[model samples]
Target: MTLSLNDLPLRDDLRGLTPYGAPQAPLPIALNVNENTHPIPDAVASDILDDIALAIRDVNRYPDREFTTLRESFAEYLGHGLTPEQIWAGNGSNEVLQHILQAFGGPGRTAFGFAPTYSMYPLIAQGTGARWIPGTRQPDYTITPEEAAEQVRTADPDVIILCTPNNPTGTPLGLDVVEAVYEAARGIVIVDEAYQEFAPHDAPSALTLLEGRPRLAVSRTMSKAFAFAGARVGYLAADPTFIDALRLVRLPYHLSTLTQAAAVAALRNSDVMLGMVEEIVEQRDRITATLEALGYTPHESWSNFVLFGGIADPRATWQQLFDRGVLVRDVGIPGHLRVSAGTEAETTAFLDALASIGSAS
Candidate 1:
């Protein structure tokens, strides 16, 4: 007997979606993606090779389904006493966010976050069949906890995501705001600190708020500060119960053996990573100053990149930079572009390029 093809309930929300793509090619200064342009130091590279050599025997077998050891090491790296049970590791924190949305959000549920934040939040929510809602942010791009809490009350969303030192803008939401959101949220409050290492004054981590708020999940990525973008390791820390739920939805052995080995090595020598972060912060300050000097006002950035308002049309400015062989991210926000802070040499090159472009314009 021939079976009919129309027998199932198919999700139509993701019908025409185009997957996310990272930048490709021979652009001179790649400050588009917020990647650390530095390579792993030679000593750290040697350690990673050694760790992989030792862990080779476990490759034939599946990775620990729970990733216990890696989770423990990651928690320690974060200076939090979180047990493995309270952690979830994924291929990247972006995947961790996806798993969260899939587990808690779907048809009839809502996932809310501020507009002009991470470009991926709404895309992920829609792909999971959740209603994606955009909330308002203050003029400085910071959102108050009270505003967030009120949105939660009205939207009754299944998930609320906040990006501190937020993407593209680099403005940080205050800790009191986070506490208020935690108190207000009946569902999950995800604080995505993808740029936490560069945040000013060691901004309060959501892990600190986890004791009282069971639904708070803080997602982090090694891709940024660790110079391990290719390693694809990201993690989520939360109350054990919420973490347990994450495990149920996560694919078994989702983090490959190579990824775990790289992550463990990276965490073991994280002090080296911190040094690079410090350098990037210094570069960011210099870039901000240069932009301000050029008569372009830049937002106070605590991340590895700076966001500024351009004197000309932002698209025109981006084209000018492109023509000058310095690639930056034109975030489509009016008169705004975000430039990733690179090395001292690269920063000098970018400034020179910007100056040439500004003079000609």
Candidate 2:
């Protein structure tokens, strides 16, 4: 008598939903997730190991409950005049986001984001017992000031999330749209800037808009640009009061000693860890250009991945690429697929494999 999930009691809201994750296959060239794909330079890896070694010596005691030193290091690294008092972190950006929802969202409250954005937003809302509302985006995936403001005013949600350089679509949101949404809404506005390091240097970040806005938060992660995805470090910058609110819901000593130590060491070598961004951006642009030449419509992207359309059979093409020892994402968009920008050699391998599959037309 095997007990299946259907036979066991489960939460009503979660009973029918599938878990969120990309497909995983063992392939020689994997560009499915937007990982940095570059190994940490040897010197930096050695430094991180040394720091982790030191942290383990204190294993007999609980780690810092506040993770004070790690917060300070993050403040210095972000430097839009941010301070330790304005910082909050968790196991990953997802957990940090979960803390936000726990503090401000619950039954009768609603969380909002544009449709076709990160899939986790809705799942996180559901898990927190909040309703999820998905707004619309332009056909090209960009949202305008008017559309955003109107939607926020109408939804009047408890928490609003805006994903710049949106995942799966690679669309970049404008700051003006963010401002409009913030003004029209009565709740918190979170800007998920997971790919900020890959954007142009001249671009202004939502951090510039944080000083006077207490309900605004700009979240970042070391996963993409720092090649620290495995380190599980994600943080956000916001008002001290907002940070205090999260503290109420978070578990004691949420970040372990080893995690804090590795993140701090990586921050210490920020220049070296970030040196790969320029190269990754180059490969992203290369992918976009080659995609166009190959007769696909590659959407404009400021991040380290390219999402191209014109695929006649997305799943088959994905499988063909998989069979050829390369892996890319079939992100559920009809006639389209997304591929992360990898190392120079890896990028060539992906592009060559894609070429061999022939044009989607």
Model 1 lDDT tens row, 1-361: 6754344455567655677764565887888899999889999999999998878878999877777779889878876677777888888888999899989997889998887799899988998789899888888787666787787688777899998878989988887888887777788889998899898765677677778678888889998999988888889888888987887788878987878888998899999877888889999999998888888889988789999985568878887888887889877788788899999888998999888876321
lDDT score for residue 113 of model 2: 98
User: Cα-based RMSD of the predictions, in order?
Assistant: 3.6, 0.8
Model 1 residue 302 lDDT score: 76
lDDT of 2 by residue, 42-123 (tens): 9999999999999999978889988999999999999988999999999889999999999999888999999888889999
Which stretches of candidate 2 lie above 4 Å from their native place? Answer: none
Q: How does residue 170 of candidate 1 score in lDDT?
A: 92
Cα displacement (angstroms), candidate 1, residue 318, comes to 1.2
Q: Give the residue spans of candidate 1 off by over 4 A.
A: 1-11, 359-361
**Weakest lDDT window of 10 consecutive positions for candidate 2:** 19-28
